[model samples]
Target: MKVINHIREVRQRKGITQIKLAEDLQVTRQTINAIEKNKYNPSLELSLKLAEYLDVPFTSLFYLDKSEENAE
Candidate 1:
């Protein structure tokens, strides 16, 4: 499934860099980069934490591709 996220845009709007966000999450900048690039999927707990950190609702932050749903 495609892990679509608005994190990059939102983070940019919030004036937060990947390095800063990673520090807040106690992870590495590469980890945040992976998530933003869709090379990695964060755990459910991490997803929630991300939403909390970005001040956005979870549903707003992450979503599965509707095309994937149609394939099911």
Candidate 2:
């Protein structure tokens, strides 16, 4: 199983820069970068905040993957 975050895609689609997102989230750009790279997992509160900021559902930003599902 792998944890995947679609932050980069969502941000791009929303035309939002990492720095801007960081500022809105009150986090560092590095933290946003880490989350985008899957190097860090945000807390539930942060996740909800991100969803709100991006105008996306929480699941649209993050998801769980199964090996079998990924293979398809």
Q: Give the best candidate by TM-score.
A: 1
lDDT tens digits, residues 21-52, model 2? Answer: 99999999999999999988888998899999
TM-score of 1: 0.90
Q: Write the per-residue lDDT of candidate 1 for residues 17-62, one digit (tens) a residue.
A: 9999999999899999999998899998889999999999999899
lDDT of each: 0.93, 0.90
Query: Alpha carbon lDDT of residue 4, candidate 2?
Result: 88
Badly placed stretches (over 4 Å) of model 2 are 68-72
The RMSD of every model to the true structure, in order and in angstroms, is: 1.5, 2.4
Score every model by TM-score. 0.90, 0.87
Q: What TM-score does candidate 2 get on C-alpha atoms? A: 0.87
Candidate 2 Cα lDDT to native: 0.90
Best by lDDT: 1
